[model samples]
Target chain A: MKFLTPAQVTALMQDAVDAQGVDLGQIRAQLVLSPSERVDWLIAAVENLRAFRQKL
Target chain B: MTFDPRVICRILAEEGTEFVVIGGFAAAVRGSTVLTFDIDVVPDRERSNLEKLARALRRLNAQLRTGSEVLPLSINADFLDQMQVSLTLTTDFGDLDLVFQPAGPKASYADWADGADHVDLGNRLIVAIAALDDIIASKRAANRVKDQAALPALEALSEQIKSQT
Candidate 1:
């Protein structure tokens, strides 16, 4: 994946804060998942998305 | 620009672009399914084709970088001279990698519309992914520890295919 520019990351982070009612920091925390971890990476990714969108 | 990876694969296939499925989608195509967000294609031939591809991307406003710096928003062509390029796309959605299969006598291609069991992607075109049998061979040839770990599941799928055959 390409690196997100600092500005773009900040803007996206802000949007998540305004649109979802969760914490972006927590969501970012969950984005990293091992490909073969036995646990469901998709489920973890979803929670990350929710945590990212905690504004509304 | 914004296209579904499967759809893109089908289109490329129709355009006579020969490729093999890799990544999570390849596993899914082999029936040990997993969620895949990007298209992973390895061309049947490398070298000349890869050079042509590098020139094409050079014209597309893509900046090729190396080292600790992350890949730019488009394909990187700087490493093409080495033979194959592992093309990665990073979009607003996520990231996908399409690694070109290294060329020469060692290369192989998949057959589409094998007419037995097939899933039509669009326009009646199907994803002629590597057969379960071949996936086993490749994962073994890859020989990475992680890839080896996937061998049993792949072998099981191959066994199932053999039984069906």
Candidate 2:
């Protein structure tokens, strides 16, 4: 119902990405992407994070 | 060559399909850190929207992912308007699960609409994604091993979001 602001959503996403072992360097590299492309990279990052966790 | 969930989301959004993105993909969008191969959505069961949903699925080349035989059933307006249960399909993009009943506190897309958040993925791809609380409730209600495992973190994330407000 209530929507989180874009800032809040970004902060939560960063926390989850860090907790799931996605590195800052990787995200930094993706920062250059357009907003749309950045969304794609983030989705891939989540998949990679899960794949990394599965190997452990 | 797996396609992102966004691919399907864009297709449905462009077709004006009335749906709320739910399940794991919703969790991921909300920053759950959970990975899901499929995109699950609860399409509005209204006769008009259901027809639109069928057309969108057809455009994606959806095939039955459930039964032993992978038939590409005609997801016509009749099927959508009449089907009582959820439908799961495999597509070029990936797995796409269309549910009328999502099995939690909010069992239907109609139940979830009030709480849904419209997400703009840039490039004119706008989707209505389920709220975090609803996703957590749905997962808890589903109670599968993976769903259970995801709870702790989702719960923590939910709390974190609450605290920020």
Candidate 3:
């Protein structure tokens, strides 16, 4: 197993954080959805993830 | 199993459990684009309400989730009264967290209820969602890496929601 150095780990963590940061465009798109729609969106996303995991 | 929060909310409502939806699901309901797989709620501490919640939990086949170990949970009003912190459980429908005292402004279930917005989830299932301000406050107080990451979008949504009102 290869172990990342401290600096390498920090850089990877920072990249993950950057990738997860907020996007105003996405927020606006989501705002167009009613509360019920939002719930459906979440459920769909979760189902997609579950399917993806089963393939692994 | 896939996460289905609507079914979870419906069960709670059907059992007449008094609870306010909180955490990431609440944020999503209020227009944040964050994707959360679990539903978090703050149930009323009143004995009768706790009994109702217990029935809902049983119907969900809920088990206490502690890291990798899933333990059987025997829930009742007394068990709920002794819980001073959050309880995370995995149900047949999805994950549910019962938060007794969230770390934010007016941190009680009653407080969240006082300012909650009634949202219709269709089919006559209306649930109370914690206000955007309260959700933001709780996330800020939690200060976890994921919570911190979600704050910006939630704050922007809050501003947008306020502007339209």
Candidate 4:
């Protein structure tokens, strides 16, 4: 599987805030995320990537 | 004493040490929010480069960190030249792992140099970091439970990155 470039990661982080109204940086900073909640975030991130990739 | 990694990077760069930051630090540099305790680096294996690294470590007051009897000894050029492939030391700045060969497609510092990412820290301080993809590959190869735990975040981050360019 191809890995993401630096620019792509930065763009995705920015897009998360702009398009999805989610700030992953803030989510990561939250200390109370349960194990399952973190898993959910990962799943959502993957789906986001899939959607973003299709747009390219 | 908690050591800021930016200081560690600057110290190495200022000393003209030939090395690349790898492992968790590299992942973090590329936007993986993985928390890492130590700064892992693959320093060039050449005698001269190792000499430079020894000097930098000395300046940091590096000492072997282990549960066994703590040795008050120090790492110097002559000692490093005769040492093994990897050494883990504790410094005033925290743990600094010197890896001679990282566990990945790129086995040595020279091998990864071309693919490494350069991070400019302003004021003419530049440091090399291993590529995120390679870090992922190495993590997968390591396959420890901790390493396994890091994959999802890194994978998802990779996807997000792939979407950008």
- Name the best candidate (by lDDT): 3
- What is the DockQ (computed on Cα atoms) for candidate 2? 0.10
Model 1 spans with C-alpha error above 4 angstroms = A1-56, B1-4, B10-16, B34-38, B46-69, B73-85, B91-94, B102-119
Error of 3 at B59 (Å): 0.7
Which candidate achieves the best TM-score against the true structure?
3
Residue B79 of candidate 1: its Cα lDDT? 65
Better of 2 and 3 by lDDT: 3
For A1-56, candidate 3 gives per-residue lDDT tens digits of 99999999999986676567767677788888888898888788878888898899
Put down candidate 3 lDDT per residue, B57-130, tens digits, no spaces: 99999999998889998987788889998899999998999999898776788899999999986677899999
lDDT of each: 0.47, 0.77, 0.88, 0.72
Q: What is the C-alpha RMSD of each candidate to the true structure, in Å?
A: 15.2, 9.8, 5.6, 13.3
- In Å, residue B31's CA in model 3 sits off its true spot by 1.2
> What are the DockQ scores of the candidates, in order?
0.03, 0.10, 0.48, 0.03
| C-alpha TM-score for every candidate | 0.49, 0.76, 0.88, 0.72
Instruction: List runs of model 4 lying over 4 Å from the truth.
Output: A1-56, B67-70, B122-124
What is the C-alpha lDDT profile of model 4 across B4-68, one tens digit per residue?
Answer: 56677778887899998888766766666555767889888888888888889888888887767
